[model samples]
Target: MIDWLNSTALTVFGVGTTWAEVLGFVTGLLNVWLLIRQHVLNWPLGILNVLLLMVVFGTAGLYADMGLQVVYVILGLYGWWAWLYGGAGRSELVVRTTTRAEWLGLAVAGVLLTGGLWLFLDRMTGSTVPLADALTTALSLLATYGQTRKLVESWWLWIAGDLIYIPLYGYKDLWLTAILYVAFLTLCVLGLRAWRKAIG
Candidate 1:
């Protein structure tokens, strides 16, 4: 039984999938688990997950995603510091709702950024599903920034991005990643509820 189970594990994490992505998914799960509890340690673990993803995306030639990993690194650092010293008296950041103007800005920015990235990828790079990919990618960036600031609206953006991302990753032949995004979608919903309750 042990041998058989080991073989199955090997096959699942075999030739197509690398150890880095597996580790990445594990760290991502851990990060989210901590995040749900509003733990500061989540930021560091999240950074580790992004680092692993950076390697995975680079190997897959998903340039936009690979580049996003770099951005994640910077954001992770900022988030770490901000969460540590971005509240009253420079304390931990807390959840906040988007103001009317912020909502308008996020909507307009999400659309404009998505359109711009689509054009850039479609015209400049030989990207498959360039428009769809770019749109999700751009919005995810906005979402990530929002999350760092502990904004409740980040959950909504994540939901939208992950909804599109699951299919995109699947279409890209990244089966494991597609699965990860599915989990992310669920967590986004949970995070929203959790943050709302905390804020209220």
Candidate 2:
């Protein structure tokens, strides 16, 4: 299965897109689509998407991104339960805005964590795009945490990360994944709009 998934799916603009990228693209789209509608199933779907992308990123030497997929799985589990029960009286979670304190803490954590990961990826790994990768990773972590809490601001963080990710994936010659991030950018915008309304 691993070998098959790593094999070329098609050649597009001289880039040999892999089956893993193709499958990840589909699951990733559905995962985000479901999340926008506040569905619990997005968690399992997202886990699958990240696992496939782990292979893609590992091949591309995007170590931070490959590692990010591992963390996403952990966060996905928490998010799954959060959506189902992390609410008043262990009920379903609802959309909410981040408090000022939460915003400040997330900002600080993003900066600090990005620095730490960037340093590690720079010195401890062969990651040429460590800073870019680390920045996106931090943003993704913040976004995922906020999303798990049903925070409306999570989509904004995803938007920021997607902006960087599109070009990064393109630079890595992962054309399909670049396109996936473009789709993610669009979905993040729509999700933000939808969640804003859901806050009421």
Candidate 3:
């Protein structure tokens, strides 16, 4: 069964379907769905998704992305705890808008991180899409942090990252992953609206 699934190639997209990719895709979908509903389960599901994708990205030569998954695991754990206890008086976290100062700080951090990763990948690795990979990684880190804080602006950062990720994943021939990002883009829009309503 595993071999059959791993060897099966989708004729339409010419991308081979693997068990890791399938698992990653399924968990990725569930993670975003839970996130849209603001369920605490999203964090645990996200941890599984990232672990599965680590294999996918590692094979596809997306070193930065593979590394990003490691970060996602740590962030996922943090988010799980934060959502349950990082609120006022150890209550559930609530949706909120990012302050101007917070936004400025995050923007600066993202720029510096992107630049640093770009340089590292360019000099130290054989990454095919270093800049795009670095940019998405940096934005995703910020987005995940925002999500942990239950900030509505996290969806905005995710929207931006997904826009870049779709084409980049496609270029790497990870068609299913690219399609997942398209779904992510849609979910980001929905999540933004949902969080806004919650905040108001």
Candidate 4:
């Protein structure tokens, strides 16, 4: 079993890509788990996740995703501060539902942005599955924004995007990242359950 494990690790490393994918995966899980508990630590762990992923995705030629990692770092910093003090009278952020208008706006924006990102990725780059990959990437951005604001509906967006991401990452031959997203999907469900109970 040890030899088999060593062989697998060697094969993965022989591909000449960074092994930070595994590290980012573990930290990403920690980040989301903290998110479910409404802990501020999630943001710092999330920052680490994105910082590591920026390297992993950049090496894999996922430029849009690489850029998303950079954006996530910025948002993670903002989110860290916001969750700490952006609430009523500088209190902790509270879970809140999006308004109907906000929900509708997000839906429309997801569709438009998905299409736009797909076109941009396809026309501008040599990325594989640019359309599908970009669609998931775009929606995930909106979802992440909603999460940082403590929106109760963010889990829904995360679930949707992560569902799409599983196959996309699988297609990209990042089995570890694909599995990480599958775990993310499960956490999204748990996040929904936890946040709903906490908010009420």
Q: After TM-score superposition, what is the CA distance of residue 57 in candidate 4 from its true location, in Å? A: 1.2
| Worst window of 10 by summed lDDT in candidate 4 | 1-10
- Give candidate 1's error at residue 114 in angstroms: 1.2
lDDT of 2: 0.95
My TM-score estimates for the predictions, one after another, are: 0.89, 0.98, 0.95, 0.90
lDDT of 2 by residue, 1-200 (tens): 99999999998679999999999999999999999999899999999999999999999999999999999999999999999999999999999999999999999999999999999999999998999999999999999999999999999999999999999999989999999999999999999999999987
In Å, residue 178's CA in model 2 sits off its true spot by: 0.4
The lDDT leader among the candidates is 2
- In angstroms, the error of model 3 at 91 is 1.2
Better of 1 and 4 by TM-score: 4
What range of 10 consecutive residues in model 1 has the weakest lDDT sum? 2-11
Spell out the clash pairs found in candidate 4: none
Q: What is the lDDT of candidate 1?
A: 0.81
lDDT string for model 4 (1-200, tens) is: 22222232323423422357777788999999999999999999999898887777776778789888888998899899999999999988899989999888888888888888888889998888887778878777888889889998899989988988898877777778888999999999999999889878
TM-score rank, highest first?
A: 2, 3, 4, 1
- RMSD of every candidate to native, in Å, equals 4.8, 0.7, 2.0, 4.6
Model 4 segments more than 4 A misplaced: 1-17
Error of 3 at 92 (Å): 1.0
Ranking by lDDT: 2, 3, 4, 1
